[model samples]
Target chain A: MIQKILYNFKKYKFLLQQLVSRDFKVKYKRSVLGILWSLLYPILMMAVLAIVFTNVFKFSTPGVNYLVYLIIGLVIFNYFSEASNLAMSSIVSNFSLINKVYMPKYVFPLSKCLFVGINFLLTLIPLYVVIIVSGTELNIYHLLLPYVFICLFMFTLGMGLLLATISVFLRDMFYIYGIIQTMWLYLTPVMYDISMIPENFQTLFKLNPLYQFINFARSIILYKNIPTIGQWAGCGVSAVVVLIFGIYIFRKKQDKFIYYV
Target chain B: MKKETMIKINDVSMRFNLGIEKEFSLKQWFVNIFNPRKFKKEKQEFWALKNINFEIKTGEVIGFIGSNGAGKSTLLKIVAGVMKPTKGSIETYGNICPMIELGAGFDMQLTARENIYLNGAILGYSKDLLDSKFDEIIAFSELEEFLDVPVQNFSSGMIARLAFSIATIVDPEILIVDEILAVGDIAFQAKSEAKMMEMITGGTTVLYVSHSLEAIKKLCSKVVWLEKGNIKEIGNTKDICDKYENYTIKHMAGNYDI
Candidate 1:
């Protein structure tokens, strides 16, 4: 499987670049703010969530700034959701090219992930500005951001691939996924902290992939500490398992995707 | 001297499942899971292509002529590697430019200049290659003034011109065209025909599908006539065109003749 993916990557490298750029171009085309929307989305979500949780709910953490904490979780969660959502529809949306041309099926979903990945990274500029302006101390621990991000990216891609395959057979998956994401957001402790969860359920909550990823990010960015070895293992294991499952499901179903599309 | 085979098809067949009562909605799929007999699925099938066998020599210009739903496009798709046949296999050498769905790579919101690179990349051209050929592509398309304009604003003919320009930029080993010229204007058609003639002279193997019998007779050395997912005739262009024209006239008049 790895060999096949590597071979396809070598052959379709140009195609992948073009696809990712095309996504960026189409997304920003005719829009005045262009990529500013990427930063705006998370910031706006942070504002609303911060006001609600800090004021009405009166939620507080001992050491971390609530805004920084919420932004970190929201940005990471938004990346996962947006990337997977776009990738989910990648196959269905590219039916025109799929019906007429022959290329690797995975490139579609992978390109969407890369596209959203770029947007996610770009939005972090604003995220960092907020973090630094809030007088948070920078340290070497923050350098491990890529480690946490890679975990989130792989996990999103895995879900995206699975969703892309299933969406081909059932067109309703795009809408169904929206509902799932909303519920998933509430479950991931994005708006509320992990402290809100009862002691018995905390372990159960950690089982959620995004929960582990968010915790990883919070450890590095907010707490200025690296995640434990177990946390790293959990993130890596879930990512690889889902990615392998995704590739397996995609390869199994891809031959029939053209027919349904 | 022996001619090298560019494409080899041995007993290729395409089967399509059709007229099945599929659950188009999630709610329907769920309900049907409980009540399996509620919607009876009639499993009707169609043989889009049946036991197709052919070989094309390098530098040969071949034309596939048939009526609608005669499996002409299906055969092209198989050769282009767009769709897999249910039976048998096709072996093709070198790069193939499938001009069947021209402008399939274009994002309508993007400008023509951007789309040229995008479409060129899809056709397996590198970024540097596209960059170098950008001016040539624009000149061929004659859409220089509209370069900055998005494709959505362009007419269908303009889009076709752009697509044709990018596709024909590099002479491909195998060129698969399927009635794409039907969309563009007469001037662009004449220009494209001239370009195609140049490719033919340059030893590009061509597998073309078009309703224009005149073009096929003029350009193709060989012709394959298909009817109802089966090859009816394969011979020199003149003979097949003559027989196909007669067959069409007869079939139109309710006479079962070939």
Candidate 2:
């Protein structure tokens, strides 16, 4: 499977690059600030959430700066939400091109992931800014953040493939995913700490694949600690498992997409 | 020496479900899951192409002539690998550039210059190739002044001109042209036709589908006449086209059967 994906990547490298750039351009075409919005949007959201949770809800994390913690969670979760949402609609949205061309179908969803992945990387600049402004120590462990992001990207791409396939057959999946995303946001504890959950339900909450990813990011950025081997294995396994399942479903159903779309 | 076969279609067929009750929503799917009889009763199968068999040698220019529902487009799509045949197989050699619909990949909000690259990439042109051919494409399209303007503002003719220019920039081994020659004004149409003629004379194996018998006669050496998903006749362009013209005349004169 990896070999086939790599082969396709090499064969369609230029097309993929063009598609990603096109996505980037189209996203910011009319905006005055353009690409700077990617950096500013997350920071603005972080400020609002930090103020609300700290002042209104009075939430606190012992020994960890709340600003850095909130920014890390917001950045990672925002990427997950935006990437998966964009990918879910990618196939249905490109029905015109798909009907006329013979390029690989997976490129649509893959391109959305890549487009959002670049934005996610840009948003990291704000994340680093928040860390410095909060006076958090930058450590060697911070370099390991890329590993967590790769895992999250794989997971999001897999979910995107699955959703893109389903959305082709059923238009209702689009609205249904919006509801699921809202519920998923609240359940993943982006605004609150996982310790806030009763000890009995912590394992159940950890079962959410996103929790593992968000926790991985927090461990590196906010806590200044390296993730344990078990945590690393958990993120990698869940990402790979979801990605494989997504590819399997997407490949199985992609041929029917031309008809339904 | 006999030329190599560029395309071989072996008993290919395509089937589409014409049922209106297709499960397009999760609610409908769930309702049908509990009522299997409703799901089974609404199936209406449509055979777009049936038992299609043909071969085109290298450098052959083939024209397909039929009424609107004769499966000419479907056949082109299957050969282009855009759609799979329900049964049988197609063996094709060399690259195929299918101009099924012009500007299908264009993002209307993107500028004309950006669209050139985006559409070029969709047609499988590498960046370096597009960079070199960029001037020729712009020159051929005649949209140089509007390069910075978004494509949404361009007239439909301008869009078609740009699309046609980008698609034909590369000469593939097989060229699939579906009913898109009537683009832009008469002069532009003539210009595009001449460009197509150049490609045809350059030894590109062509599968041309058009409603204009005049264009077909001018371009193709052989013709395939399809009727109701079956090949009614396949022979020299003159013979088949003559027969098709007669059949059309007879059918138009209130004679339903020929």
Candidate 3:
């Protein structure tokens, strides 16, 4: 299976470049300001939320500056949402390619994840600036950011591949995706900080691994503290399980996917 | 004797279920899950093709003629590997190119040049090969000025011209063409026909499916007539085509005009 994927990757080299390039171009094509929109997204969201909740309206984001903390979690959650929301529909949208050729089928979602990944990387520059301007001290704990990001990636990819396969066989998946995507935003503790939850509920809420990821990222970037070893292990274990199950189901279901598509 | 063999499919069969008789709903899903057949499930499993076997030699053009849903495209798709046969094996030694569904690689959102590179790669062209052949493809497609524009803007004829141009470039040992060539203009169609002839003369195998019996007569050396998922006739193109025509005339009560 790995050899098959590798061979297809080599065979479709030109196609990969074209797809990535097309994605880049189509994103910025018609806008008067072009790719400036990329910078505008997180920055604008951070500012608007910061103003409404903290500095202007005094809605309170706890001890951290509403702008900085929200921006941190927003950047991470955006990556997951962007990857998953589009990933669910990746195979369905690209029926043009799926209908004709026999590809690995996992590549479409992975390619889309890469597209959002590029955006994530782009969003990081401003995130670092926010980190600096917030006057937060950096330490060895900050070095672990890459590990947290990988967990986020694997967790999202697991779900993305699962949703792609399920949606292929079931049209009801589309309706379900809309509801799930909406609820998932709140589930991840994106717009609101996790501390708002009562202490009794922390264990229950953190049981959802996605919130654990957001909390882990926030603890490191905002508080300059790494997650406890137990939390990290939990996130890691969940990530591994989700990805393994996701791939297993995707490969098994993919043989019939062309017919469904 | 050195016999030229292009493609071989042995005892291929395909069956599909049309699914439940009623529209699937959440309640129905749960009910059916428990009962396994709570809804009026139609046992609509039918073989679209059964025990289909054929072999075409190098430089031979084979025409597949059948009524609607005769499993022609399904058989072609199996040969293309776009689909796998349920119960048989299909083997081809050379580069197999299938045009069973024209513009399968095309995305209207991308420009023609972008699509050409993308589509060509999907069809198994190496980068260097496509780079050199790029100009030739554009010239064949006659879309030099419109190359930068998204393909959704192109007419179906333009799409057909580009697809055919790319399809022929494979120099495939086995080439599969559906009824897509009929989309282009008369002049372009003539040009396409010339391209197919050149491929045939160069010892490539061509398997064609077309409603135009006239073109089939002109191009194919062998004709396979299929009816209800089985081969009705397989022999010299002229002989079977003639008999098939007479049978069709009989089906239409002899009202057809010459």
Candidate 4:
């Protein structure tokens, strides 16, 4: 399977590059800010959430700056939601091409992940800006952030694949996922600290994969500490498990896609 | 010397489920799980292609002739590797260029120049190859001035011209053409037909599907006449075309059931 994947990657590398760039171009086409919006959007959202949570909601983290903490959670969770949402409809939207030519179907969803992944990386700029502006000390542990980003990316790609496949069969998945995403945002400690959750339910909340990912980022960025072995294990396992399951389900249903699409 | 076989279709069949509910939401699916009678009533099997078997030797130009709903497009798609057959398999040697639809991958929001690279990449052309052939494609397409304009602004004929130029830029071992020859204006149609003739004579194995008997007779040495998902006849182009013409004439006169 690895060999086949590698071969396909090499074979379709040009197409993949084109697809990612196309997504980037089409997204910002008419907007005056163009690519700059990716950098600015997160910062603006973080500011609004930071003001409301600190002033109105009275949320706080003991040692960490709330602005930095909020941005990290926002960036991570936003990537997951946005990437999965776009990738979910990737295959269905490209049925015109799928029906006429012979290219790997997975490229559609994979390219969506890559496009959003690039956007996620750009949002990291605003994240660091908030860190510096908020007077949070930068540490060498910050270099380890890529580890978390990779984990988040893998998890999102997997979810994207799963959702893309499901949405092909059930058109209602689009709206259903929107409601689930909103509920998920509230469940995750993005604006509020984890300490605010009740003790008994905190354990259940940690079981949410996004919770592990957001917490892993916080360890390296906000707390300026390397993630514990347990943190590493949690992030790695969830990412790999979801990705493997996604690939399995996607490959199984891909052949049938031509019929339905 | 005997030529090698470039393509072989072995008992390929395609079955489509003509279910009453073409699409189902998760809620509906869960609700219907307990309704066995409703589930049973929804399934209606449609065999688009039935036990299709054929082979094309190297450099052989084969034409597929059929009336509407005769599975010509399905068979073409299967041969192009866009769709898998239900019960059989197809083996083909060498690269295949399936011009099933012109500009199928063009993003109308993108400029023509951008689309050239995008569509070229989708067709498996490397950046270096597109760079080298970029001028040639534009020159052939006759849209050099309109390169910066978005494809959505272009007329259908311009899009077809651009697509044709990009698709025929490289000669592959196998070429699958499905009713794309009659594209653009009459002048452009003649030009594309000439280009196709050049490829056919240059030893590219071609599988062609067209309703135009004149085009089939002029290009294909052999023809496969399909009727309602079955091959009614397969032989020399002139012979098969003659029989197909008579069948269509008879059917039109209401002497035949369908």
Measured by TM-score, the strongest candidate is 4
Taken over the whole model, the C-alpha lDDT of each candidate is: 0.86, 0.89, 0.78, 0.88
* Docking band of candidate 4: medium
lDDT of 2 by residue, B84-135 (tens): 8989899999999887887878999999899989998888888888999999
Worst ten in a row by lDDT for model 4 chain A:
A39-48
- Give RMSD to native, each candidate: 2.5, 1.9, 3.2, 1.8
Ranking by TM-score: 4, 2, 1, 3
Candidate 4 segments whose C-alpha is farther than 4 A from its true place: B26-31, B255-258
Error of 3 at A13 (Å): 4.1
Distance from true position, residue A34, model 3, in Å? 2.0
Cα DockQ of the candidate 2 complex: 0.71
Per-residue lDDT tens digits of candidate 3, residues A1-261?
899878877876666666666677678876898888888887777767777867666654766666667777678878887898788898889877777765556777877777888889889888888878888766788788788788878888888999988877676787888888778777667667667889898777778777777778778877777689977987798888898888889988876766554
Q: What is the TM-score of candidate 3?
A: 0.88
Separate DockQ for every predicted complex: 0.62, 0.71, 0.45, 0.74
User: Global lDDT for candidate 1?
Assistant: 0.86
TM-score of chain B of each: 0.89, 0.93, 0.87, 0.93
Please give, for residues B26-129, the per-residue lDDT of candidate 3 as tens digits.
Answer: 66577666775644464457788899998877778889998889888888877888777778888887888776666676767788888887778667678898
Residue A7 shift from truth in candidate 3, angstroms: 1.7
True contacts kept of 2: 0.74
Looking at model 3 chain B, report the run of 10 residues with the lowest lDDT sum: B19-28
